[model samples]
Target: MSGDRLTAEVVFDTSVVEDPGDAVLAGVARVLAGAAPAWADRMVAWSPEPRERREIDALATLPDVVRGRTRWATQDRHTGNVELRGATAELNVVVSVNSSPLARVGGRLLLSNGITLTGLREQVAGEPRTDWMRAVFGEICAATRPVWGALYSASEYRAKVMADGPVLRALGRDFSRHLPGLFAGNYFGAPYVGLIGERVFERIGAPAARKAADGWFVDVLHDPFAWRDDDSVTRNADLLAELGPECFFRKGAAEGRVTRAPDW
Candidate 1:
């Protein structure tokens, strides 16, 4: 269960990148057209920003075409490091973003802004499809709308955010050491299922949550083998501690950060 490849990464943290000029890149080109137009019909292979300033062969010059017939990629008005290839091997995706994935911006704690999604497990051993990636990760969380996100794995997202057994201490962009970028103290950092944007706090510990076509969808496993059944992963970790403590920040909670769903 460890090796043999089975990664369905669809992570998100938000900063809405793509900045060499903006306009039509509108939130990561809708996550490369929601990750399925065979990721823009193959050919983009980027890696140019650290503040890339032209002349890397003029950065190939496709300026946001995306769909078919656009060989190179990233017309860069900002952010690069893309890569796509699909005809086989599970549409080889690798869009590691972070051209400034939120360093700081009026925060109390909770800071992180990654964006990852590696090739969707090219048939990772037996039973790989993992429920057909929950409708392409709910359309990549309705096109990059994630203040918090998850599809889970690597020990079922650390027993579904058990919060490092009272060891949580992330403070800033760590991505995942089992997630806990600190929203105050008890950093529950929501994601027992995935995609829970809009006002991410106002309490939603799951009752099959609801609403999606844009945001919110914590539908905890009716399938996906019930997370290998340990009584359905301990009832989805008691529905993520019934999302109390003012929608999770622990220790009397509610002090700062993620005031429900603050991003753009």
Candidate 2:
């Protein structure tokens, strides 16, 4: 059987201590280094019954996917695949951060930083379903949410933009500022901006209190209902909107469920 191409990107920016670009890179490294679910917990999740240890093997080799860079550039394809019940999904990730200096605000220097997580995946027929990617992304959320909270010590952060599939493609074309050849397939991202206190400046630190607006997109995707097989932009938007900023858990996809939609 043939395979279907699926790509996604989760892009966002939060207040970072010191350099914005460096901080975002550091944050992602920490997450992939077993910061979110913890290496031990993920090992267990990979082999719940102790015999299914393929993921364990994959986990040992995950470090290759965890990458960072100061400048925005096209990366050599870094691809890997996982079996997802009836399908084999191939995926790769690219992370980039750009920092912008802004005029001082509230008696402190203001900065506008950018972070982009671009990835491509192809789901081919025939395979055992797995949750490794979801698990990894969840860990990413766990790792970044608190940092966003601390960065935005005042007013809080909210997703200003979110896109998927063709809509995302169109948005990318319209903007045309993203790195050339950075996106492989349809993209998915949620961009935001926020403010933070000047006193909290450092390279890396412990997580702080979290807020509803912080990492809302990641929170939504972590839910089982985030993925769909259909190519309808309107439908996906409705699904995401339904999962609003305040909703952190699944509430049943009874209304606009796309049963035939492919899982991401």
Candidate 3:
């Protein structure tokens, strides 16, 4: 979030889904069905390397051919897959603006991964993220209805991933992950932008919580990196704790944390 590139992610749990196909192609269909039921045909996926650039319209076919874990990346670089563990399967779908041509935006049912939840992140460069982006992300959060999710600066996210202990307890991703279910997944203290699913939203009652299509949205700054030293970070972190301290491991994680301000 140095004002040049901003990457944001949202993660949720898609384990034990509503449907898992019995055959390979059928499973693919099921996967597609949930890829982005809201956006429908707007979502698309492409095959991995060593394989030609094969684009698979996820919404066209998925989750119906095979009732097992799978992994696939889209043409836009978003990654999603149903992971298998012993006899259980979980979905991890990632949506991001970091990839080139950020057009595709759908996979699984939720985003991010820390442990029990899955994840999806977006990255955008050249400008401060717009409220429209945040709203769009909010819409995505509503669709996924994740237990909790966040939009953090890439640098801030990396920082928490490096310094925070229970961040896993807060958030999770599919590829490199742990089983953390704290709140807002990897949000060390409070996210620059945060979202709460229905269940928790009904409980926390944060005054600033805004009602979205399907979830509750919260934010501490206009743009994630807008201010590196604003006291609002601590105030926001305190508010999060005041609202739902048990939702996270370090309720005051964002306190005194200075991020790189955006140039815009």
Candidate 4:
């Protein structure tokens, strides 16, 4: 049977107070080195791209969105500065996982504003005989978790505010109002997750593929809107009803759960 391939693109805007190259490289190395077990079976292929000097300069110029929103620190490893500096880093990384041996994996990593790392993107082309691709996907997911987690953790306000339902709802409403402008260039650019989602769903079957796609979409939308609760869970439950309890939960119905009311 043919299976679907899953793709995800996650962009990280690192708020750097100090030189960011070494920290970014160290984090990437840790992920690739098996720091997250959730990724062990899922990663098909992954790599770190070189940083362009210009990109670093662009990152250094970003305006602070809010007072006290950005943090700066110093590192002696990546940059040769002796004193701490207020800087932010933008790292673009792509991860592709083939669900089927026949599926393809394409990835790219960029630093500063240029394509620092070249030749990292790959493609598998035609179908294969084995089913080992699933594990590869899992590994990629596991490896990237730390990076994402770190980014989210950087902003205590984002973390605290997003965790609350009322705040998330209000933020979602506000974000939806500006969705067009917020997502304009985001749709087709390098290191965008939407492209990854599209590729992954194309290879996988519709049901699971749609679920994954929608999940990622919702997550991204939420990031700007700050909406945290995932309503997809309820929607999924409703859809599963037609498939019956056995298939829905992947467990056969028990004797006590069935109702036997007659219309006599």
Candidate 5:
């Protein structure tokens, strides 16, 4: 079967330390270098047990897919106790796609930020049967959760919570007061905004759902749930600005590059 055509720009931010040790920095370096392919492999493999180790091995064996459809780049790893110039402490991975199941799945990943283990697990469990893609989604969700959790937990940073908190809180209040029918409407009855939307509707009623729909629509338009090259940079930067410098473990020396997917 022909694979879905997708292109993504991935960024990795390793942790910086005071008097960075060889082991730590080296490990971080390895993570930075290996994250994308590892993520891709896991996504494809979907099994935490390494099914056949085929996915991991595919990183080396499948050069065309790894190099052409996927592009991996990183910033210079800084040594010593260097103060970062950002709000959130994060290892950012941005994937841009035109038309692919990967895009839809990736949107969920981006929204979750790979931090909420429960959320990720829920997503993996809820996924529709799609053979390889389901496995890929599960693998990506499983592998990244721990990495993201470590980064956020260690630094005490909450990017999504901080960035979207006010909106969520206000929505919460709105839901408690009003019950609107529009709130129950969803994109094809599927949870576009995930459990958050459902919870809002449950607590507030219809009005809350309407507001949530509005919020979700606005979010999709402003951020556009669909893939675009470097589409996430502005949003990520905005989140970083809100989170502050200490949240970040390391800073990239350069901005990421994005390319449009070719029309088939």
Candidate 6:
């Protein structure tokens, strides 16, 4: 279910854009299409003005399009400043984009749901701010209501695991003692979350573990069995150096460095 894409209608407001050409809309559509389910289609505005309403028009004649002004509007306050109002579910998003002489594009995505996501691109500002534009669209795509049920279940699991913290740590130690090969190496490190609270002992004390997991290395580094030797402080320092200073560490934890193993 996590892999399944979301399905929804994507309606773009052409008025805020500098140009409402087909090419511009098509580029936006391309990125939006990637985040949407395979069945979703791009619905673009063919005309600048609203379509004429008919009393007896057939449903078949109507395009599968959202044909109304999103009630929200942006008022210019002063240079580099603007005011947004009427942002709600009934309104469409108000986007204001500015591409600069330095080839950087910065923009704000004001959603109908009263949420705003800002994007700034300095490294690579693609054609007509495409990179920033795609980021804005991705933010819009990700604006979903949280599933409280899932969150509650996850919280309960966390509580259960933490309630037996001591037992878990003992079990981890037993596993490490019986299977040194599974742990006691720089190849595997600890995770920031695992080192929180009393879990510092889980890494710095027994295993001499290094850094925390960051997505790709989550399983490898966070595995309880993947710890360093109790006396392998220098190895842990070397591992931290290899992992770079940017790796996440527990708050208030000493900065890692390449140093000799000191008697504990």
- Residues 1-264, model 5: lDDT tens digits: 112121111111222121234222233233333533333333231212222212323323222222223222342222111111111112222221121211223222221111111111111223421222223322332322211111111111222222243453211111111111111011211222232344433443342123322222111112112222265445444433332322232222233322112111
Computed on alpha carbons, the lDDT of every model, listed in order, comes to 0.41, 0.27, 0.36, 0.24, 0.23, 0.24
Candidates 1 and 4 compared: the better one by TM-score is: 1
Scanning candidate 3 in windows of ten residues, the lowest lDDT window is 83-92
Per-residue error at 194 for model 5, in Å?
12
Query: Worst lDDT window (10 residues) for model 4?
Result: 112-121
Point to the candidate with the largest TM-score. Answer: 3
Candidate 6 displacement at residue 172 in angstroms: 27
Cα deviation at 36, candidate 5, in Å, is 15
Highest-lDDT candidate: 1
Ranking by TM-score: 3, 2, 1, 4, 6, 5
lDDT of 4 by residue, 160-186 (tens): 223354544212111111111111001
Candidate 5's TM-score = 0.19
Q: What are the C-alpha RMSDs, in order, of all predicted structures?
A: 15.7, 15.8, 13.2, 19.7, 19.6, 19.3
TM-score of candidate 1 to 2 decimals:
0.29
* lDDT against true structure, model 3: 0.36
Once superposed on the true structure, which residue ranges of model 6 sit more than 4 Å away at CA?
A: 1-28, 32-39, 42-243, 247-249, 252-264
Clashes of 6: 2
**What number of clashing residue pairs does each candidate have, in the order they appear?**
5, 8, 56, 27, 14, 2
RMSD of 1: 15.7
Q: Residue 20: error of model 3 in Å?
A: 8.3
Candidate 2's error at 204, in angstroms? Answer: 34
TM-score, model 2 to reference: 0.34
